[model samples]
Target: MINQIYRLVSPGRFEITYRDMSLNGNKLVVRPKYLSVCAADQRYYQGRREASILQKKLPMALIHEGIGEVVFDPTNEFEIGQAVVMVPNTPTESDEVVEENYLPSSNFRSSGYDGFTQDYVFLNRDRVVPLFTELNNHTASFLELVSVSIHAIRRFKEKTHKRKETLGIWGDGNLGYITALLLRKMYPESTIVVFGKNDYKLDYFTFVDKKVLINDIPQDLNIDHAFECVGGRGSESAVDQIINCINPMGSVSLLGVSEEPIEVNTRLVLEKGLTLFGSSRSGTVDFQDAVNFLQQNKEVIDYLSQLVTNVIDVYSIKDIDSAFEEDLVSSWGKTVMEWKI
Candidate 1:
């Protein structure tokens, strides 16, 4: 099998090589079906992270979201041909996993071991969740991220003040769309508003309850809750918008990973008695809920496939850079790589 390592601090080229791993003990071999390139992957790929933190986490493979089919297994929990989603992070019960109420476990898979960009990957069967018969490979592949969005909305529901408070979303990317869609399902009577930079993304904005451009946020619009999905240098401005748009005592869920530190109005936060949460990956309970939801709603699987824009072959590992560069600006959804035998 071949694997590519992302050597931090360096840019321009990838370190691709081959390796052999026998399924000794409980290890199983997964045939890589899809590996999604997330925004974070690009940040790490471009060497735009902090240098000290980079040194501490150096010499790691650069994939976090991936899905594959079982090719070989020692554990009977998964079948040879069963499709599965890879839960990147391995969390321990004792660890303080939450950051501002979100789980930030450091044991993500791809960063430590050889990632899912290989023809075949060796992993413990426990690290995977078998995709049900209803969902196809493409839909199954996105379960990891969708699960997080589902979990975030559920968290918001727990702290909700009203049965149907006006909701606002700060980004219209895949996570924002998924979060809005799930929020609609959870709160049928709620008015969900989506805000984003792109106007064309709003063309297919029927998934969410309502859509608006960043500039169109009505001055009178005081959302009861908001979610931030765009995390970069400008993410702080989005956070400001969310804080300003939400009514007094309204909550904001911070789900984005910003390369730059976010700035917020502390005085307003205190004056409004606001709640701010950092939501990340799904917990064990939420993970199960996501799988169950997918199993029950086959129609959503079809809709999710539309969000996938590019599916490249991992055989062209050398082309990973180009694959990401093309989709860097215009990509509305996900770009994944398929490893063929």
Candidate 2:
């Protein structure tokens, strides 16, 4: 089988090799159906700190947010024509012992093994998630990211959150828009507000009923809950906006992963008695819930696909380099690769 392996990190790009590998053991062969690129892939492609660490310590397959069809399944969990979503994290055989709230062992799939970017690749049976027919391969490819956004929204609702509370989002990126859409379903009556700088990018979020420029975000606005979706440097401003705007005892969820350490208004959080929490990937429970949500709310998801602006063929993987360059400069919604088998 041929696979795209991320070998090393360099100044301009990630060194990748398309090479052949043996398919032995209980490894199930999956044919790539569709793959979506997240901000994490961009950071890794750019040789960022986290991606560099993973590249050094382990062999990671490039794309994590993807869906595939089982081409060769010796395992009983998968059938020849089944479509499934993959959870990227799982425990490796060499993994050091660690407790986890999501999985029984550690989180380790995409990091330890080859991912779903090639024509066909081997994967463990346990990592595959069977997607329903309601979600086509293209839309199902985003199940992982949708699970992340759903988990973050659920985390925000654990407190004594009011139904009419005004929720504010700090970023207008893909994850930010998804979080907003999920919250709309969870709290139909609540007023949701989105904040970002780019008007062109913001135009893609027409699905979000309320939006505002970052500058227009009122310093004293009555914010009930805030989600920080923009990671990397300068994200502190978003956190500060949440701290300044949130009401006393309101909650803030840090869904963004910052590359640099950001300073938060600790005084404001402490003085106002704000509740803060950090959200990562979805747990197994959350994953099941997200699948159910998508199944139950198919109409909503069809509408949500409008947020997807670009879909390129995987045969044109060469175009990915240019797409990444353009995406770095300016991108509105999701960019995906359609696989033809």
Instruction: Please provide, for model 2 over 1-341, each residue's C-alpha lDDT reduced to its tens digit, 9 standing for 90 to 100.
Output: 67665432342343567787676668777777788877776665666656557556444556778888788876566789788777676544432332233444554434444555566766667667778887766677777888898877776766646644688888888788788888877777788888888787687666566788888865556877788998777488889878888888888889888878899899999999988888887645566788899888887787568656677764544555654565565557777777652
Candidate 2 has a TM-score of 0.84
Residues 55-142 of candidate 1 have per-residue lDDT tens digits of 6665566666777778777757667787777766665433444532133434665454445555566665556776677776665667
| Model 2: residues with Cα > 4 Å off, grouped in runs | 1-27, 50-59, 92-113, 159-164, 207-209, 316-323
Per-candidate TM-scores read 0.88, 0.84
